[model samples]
Target chain A: MKTNVKVLDCTIRDGGLVNNWDFDVDFVRDLYDSLNAAGVDYMEIGYKNSPKLVDTEGVGPWRFCEDDFIREVIPEKKNTKLSAIVDIGRVEVDDILPCEESSIDLIRVACYLKDIDKAIDLVEAFNKLGYETSINIMAVSNSLGLGLNEALKKVNESPVDMAYIVDSYGSLYNKDIQYLIETFKKYAPNKKLGIHTHNNLQMAFSNTIFSYEQGVEFLDTSIFGMGRGAGNCPTELILGYLNSTKYDVRPILRVIENRLLPLREKLEWGYNTAYAITGLFNEHPRSAIAIRKSNAKNNFLGFYDKLSSVETHEDIK
Target chain B: MKTNVKVLDCTIRDGGLVNNWDFDVDFVRDLYDSLNAAGVDYMEIGYKNSPKLVDTEGVGPWRFCEDDFIREVIPEKKNTKLSAIVDIGRVEVDDILPCEESSIDLIRVACYLKDIDKAIDLVEAFNKLGYETSINIMAVSNSLGLGLNEALKKVNESPVDMAYIVDSYGSLYNKDIQYLIETFKKYAPNKKLGIHTHNNLQMAFSNTIFSYEQGVEFLDTSIFGMGRGAGNCPTELILGYLNSTKYDVRPILRVIENRLLPLREKLEWGYNTAYAITGLFNEHPRSAIAIRKSNAKNNFLGFYDKLSSVETHEDIK
Candidate 1:
């Protein structure tokens, strides 16, 4: 069902976390044009994180998506609107300008369960500045039970235009996505909903589709799944699957052919053994990353032997 | 959850279909040793289809999968059992004789809904010849209503060791997979269940896992998703996700680093727009493939515009 649901391409922003945001201006401009041609609803160019707050030297544009740099990249606006994310702690309030004055149409605020209040503060500031605002609760997998209920209450009361169900750990299944969407809908009936998923579990595409079916208005995607640790669902996948003559797959293909593919050659991301295993265990991927870096003689049989021999214990949290 | 389920690596058999079975002897040997080390229950070396029947003058080894060639490749049997597939009409009974004397341990029969009788006939012959046998009914997506029930009856009467829930069109979702597993269990409770899925819909891994949760014992995978259309679920994904330390991912990774990645540059198989769309539409990906080849002038805004205008439809089946 290709309704009013919008797909926001976040390859540079979220994906930058994987490669330290090493994208060039020409690549970003081409991605913007391509995504616009591909019927993408919005292009999340990068995070508006303060470079001074985080180490930014040699980092990618996504790590520091400055307003002036973004405006310079896309000299003229097209069909797709531009968006940028700001973490509760990483961005300064003064950095956000009115939508009429800046190229960004949407400003998203991301936070953990305990920081929704701080996130709401940013959302309010952005909203007052006349920009579309969303509050994305990261690491929702760890915030099940009562924490979720309280968060939902805050979301309901917030001035945000949209609320996001962020599967930051990439640990959620389809049922979990369904539960989260239904829960959010029940609690915040008046606010629109969005989805931001990671492919650590290979469920990002399905989870996003499930959310769409449940009436989510926005979907977050990347070109070639270029987000952190296993990546985000590929934007081209959504465009192709939706089969809407409105969205062009060529833009995404161009982005892959030009930007993401080269990035892939330089930076190893996407589905790897360690990430897949961590997904299978429903645990954080730190263990898998450690194993990969250790270069422990590639002995799969040995690994399997160790896993099976371990006492069947509680599932990894 | 990682109990008695068995993994069968069919990279040569299934991926051959995508690449015209052009794999070399060395790659096959490496895969065999790696799978053995990883404790994969079975490795499908290739198909047993007759060269004469399929017109294989320049066809690849993976396409033909001759018993003699396979015997020469692996040389010795180890922890992993060797298996070969035979399509109903494409294979001659005489072509299988050497398998009985070779390292082959299983012979699988693949057929469409209309060819169950032919598949059963082959299964019976393979069983009598002292080889593990299975009947894989292809295009189960089109097997609606009585078609499924009728096929189940034939499978119940067959001598096959396992009956497969083949999502040939890559159309089945998780719930659909669960239903098919339940249906097979109801009709052929005495037989084990297997899964053969394509990634056209990106559900191959999730659907395979759903089958496992439903107590289906056999799982099929290919390396780097190197089968037809979007290809099969990546073998490494299955191995890593199964949470079986016994299924070491290194061997699979080694296979990719040494063989599949290079092959990927020459061949154009793997997850793509056409396959993903086909999966989303629950239709064959032939049209999407045609679109990709035609290089039609892309109209991105038009595509999205159409989708946005349409009333939402719930036809993700």
Candidate 2:
């Protein structure tokens, strides 16, 4: 039986946040081949944001994926369709060629709630260009209540094919994912729901699966969960859960072993107490990241004082 | 309203598998004080097994926890009560002091289902001594069908206060956990269920939460998830999730940062590709542990091929 869900490998896009998209060309190409052989539905190669727009000087080609560079990376796109994330103000409209003319099959718009209008505009443009478009509502945990409802309503009416529940802060719990999905369903019934999770609380894989059980079709993942602070749901893990005959666990495992595992020693991401604390506070991981980079990485009391106060919190719901 | 759950820390006992209970006296004592301040319900101090019976050589004081060692560790008993695990064949009856006379309040019997009769014998002795007793069914994932039901039937009639769903292999999923609990409940409805999970698949914290939501009470955790192989569900993450005013996450965080974080550099544990592969195959982690010890720690594909055959598996349920 055909499954209702699709796994999107976001290794280059999300992992870029850690290393300024400095991955070697050979590594990225091998990743493309691996994910394709592994039967992943979508491979988000990198960002479409123009380097000039973001003023990325020392950043690599993956940061601002030119059409030419993308073609060189994946000379012949196989089973895994290539995609790119475009920040609202960071990409020039002319840079995004029509889907038929470009190698990218999908163009995802990532934006804050305040920047929804720009995201919608970009989504419309990408849609008119005959590309599958998704609008990722970044940092959904911080913007709850009416602000989120209205944003969902806008995406529901927009031509975007998919709307994602992006937990950028990595603070959401299983119950939080359920509540958010219910809220999203109420306002965005017309949109195919997607999920992007982080491993701050070590809930990424489970939270993503919860979304799948809740009927969210598009799930974002990374090989070995190699992404920004705390990382994303691992491709190998979710692939095991999806367990489709078409998806081979070996290729995903191969890529994780040969390419990403050693990167972890230098990069030092995933479930750490610092990230766990930021996830608990529902704050940006900047402070935690700062602590990780400092010599006082083990000074949990200092970091705790920065986030939590002397007043004991009695609320547990 | 008060929550019907207890947090049981197995830092000394579970983590002992990694460092052979070679923790400094000051570190163990500090962990005890920290857990008490954190409002943890119980802290499993160490093993109650006799050194003479086990013929332990290099094993530290934790392996043969004497009543005197307990008194010295917690001179002033606080909020958190102390407990110890006793292996069925490794402890002599005469070595156990009466619970009221000793510093330990609980004596948990860790044994295979085959040893249920012997486990009951230990439980009965500990019970008559006025101590709470628990029968930990270690490696529940491996013995699923009839073997488990028969074991549960035995424990239900025993005087044990709690029966744990122990995933000793660091394998098992949310669905597996749910199914096993259902199977466990059917045969042992009278016993309060507890959960002990490992992080081989990075599902420890989430799986434990699933158990809590499904009515399991006691949770086994260690600071920084420091334990055998891939480790256990982190205490701080669960403490954050429980979110009770009574529980201070900071104290747990402080102990983890000050004591355990540095230990991690010397001893590697937590989810990795090799462990993830072992978790997938439902095999023992000895092979993965060997790979981790060897120079090819990052050789995930090599390990995957070792456990799994080239024949494509259509057998994921």
Candidate 3:
């Protein structure tokens, strides 16, 4: 299983959202080295979105990761390849450079249903720059049936190397994942499929396993579940379960011990009561997130009632 | 979903393993009242196994829950019923009193695969005594295939009202659970099925969902996951997900705030990496337990290699 499926570590990148991307260069360097040693196929360094595009004044380091910064952090690349994500509207076309000139091996574009055209433009540009590319359809739980069909058709026409099912709201169940996988395979049979899940419902790991069993090639994970709102599936969970001799989990453990553990003490994230409730209700985690941040008293009954009464909209707001 | 399925709160019983059952009578009384008000179906007060059997001298109060002690703890009977578990070999037949005279509503007999005969004897006794009886096969992961077949045969012949698929090792995935549920249903077609899952693999919630989908009627949970080796499934997760208007999660949340939260700060039991690894490997969590107890330096590579080499055994040992 380890030999067949590739693990992409996204702790420094996705986890940055939880901590406002306050990580230092040394932490990023250590994480890079550790992930390389752990046999991780890719490390998502950070978002490649242009700072100017997303209100840079209040944004953090992870909000706008530069190629120079990535180069400085990882002076010597090892077995692990580097990947950076660019949100459709968040990043400008000028930010992407060729893989030969930069350390990045893959440039992933994330977009909502309406932004598939914009995302594909980036994917094509990144492909022309001599970089492997992926288009991650975000909030896919809310994707219109025809929207996904259109996206898959566009992906088939583009030079993108991989297509990803992004559970941005962490709302997918195993059946939902199976459906998405089957749909993606039907439309883009030649393209590799990747999974990026959040643990809002505590189904991230299971959903990933379901996707893997269905033949997904790329799995995204984070150390200690350190991503936004309950975090991404823990990388260690996947590594431990794969049970492969070639996959050494020590480097991943070392990264957790050296970097993520301290970060956990500072930032509170993971499966909390609020997140669990939101996941169960099949609702967006904004209410849970709000409760956690404001220290507002949790009214489980009220929250549950609200979730049950209202059908969860594709758009959180 | 919540309206039909019964929830058994085992916070005081399973949580005692972590805290030594040193809870004061006041807390117990409060919990009983709170659980009743919250509309929980059953409240597992403590283990009825004899202290003489387990060498439990000087252990927590919950470790040695005598009938007299329990009688003193819950002074009044309410809407919620009381349940107590007795291990097959750990309990003496002479110790159990009929449910008619005592406040205890349910007498659960817990046994290993080899001890099902003893468990059956006790369940029969409890049934004769007019107590609702359940046979919980413990450390089920360790049961040999033949042993389970024999045990299921006994369950089919026995008069027990419920039979539980206990994931004692916290090692079962969804497919494993589905297999167990299907097998149990095949053998004991007339009996009610219960599920008790631990969060070691972080699949407890998902597995419970799987069981519920398969028509399991009883689900066991501890508030805030305060049980042995990664703890039980979080009750809040279930209540929130079931999304039934009849079951208000406020009472459960109240129990957490009033009892489990403070208890959590003092006693440790939860989803940690080491435990998650053990669950992922489908192995006993002894090494992970030792690591937590001693705070020993972890050797991930060595541990992974050792664990991987071992044949996949379902037993907790």
Q: Give every collision pair in model 2.
A: none
Clashing pairs in 3: B20-B60, B21-B62, B141-B314, B141-B315, B142-B314, B142-B315
Preferred candidate (lDDT higher): 1 or 2: 2
Give residue B109's error in model 3 in angstroms. Answer: 1.4
The C-alpha stretches of model 2 lying farther than 4 A from their native spots are A309-317, B309-317
Per-residue CA lDDT of candidate 3, range B76-119, in tens? 68789999888767887777777777778998887878778888
Query: Best by TM-score, which number?
Result: 2
Error of 2 at A211 (Å): 1.4
Write candidate 1's Cα lDDT for B1-317 as tens digits: 45779999898888786667777888889888888887899999888888878878768876666667777787778889988888778888865774458678998898877878888888888888788999887777777667778878888988889998888778777767877888888877889899998877677888887777778899998887788777888888777667576777767767776778778878777665455655655665555555545654233233334334556533322
Model 3, residue A67: what's the lDDT?
A: 75
**Preferred candidate (DockQ higher): 2 or 3:** 2
Candidate 1, residue B269: the lDDT equals 70
> Which candidate order results from sorting by lDDT in descending order?
2, 3, 1
- State each model's C-alpha RMSD to the native: 6.0, 3.5, 3.1
Rank order by TM-score, top first? 2, 3, 1
Q: What share of the true interface contacts does each candidate keep?
A: 0.23, 0.81, 0.44
Which stretches of model 1 miss by more than 4 angstroms?
Answer: A2-4, A18-30, A33-38, A59-79, A142-149, A175-191, A244-269, A277-317, B2-4, B18-30, B51-79, B94-102, B142-149, B169-191, B244-269, B274-317
Candidate 1 deviation (Cα RMSD) = 6.0
Q: Candidate 3 docking: what grade? A: acceptable
Q: How does residue B93 of candidate 2 score in lDDT?
A: 83
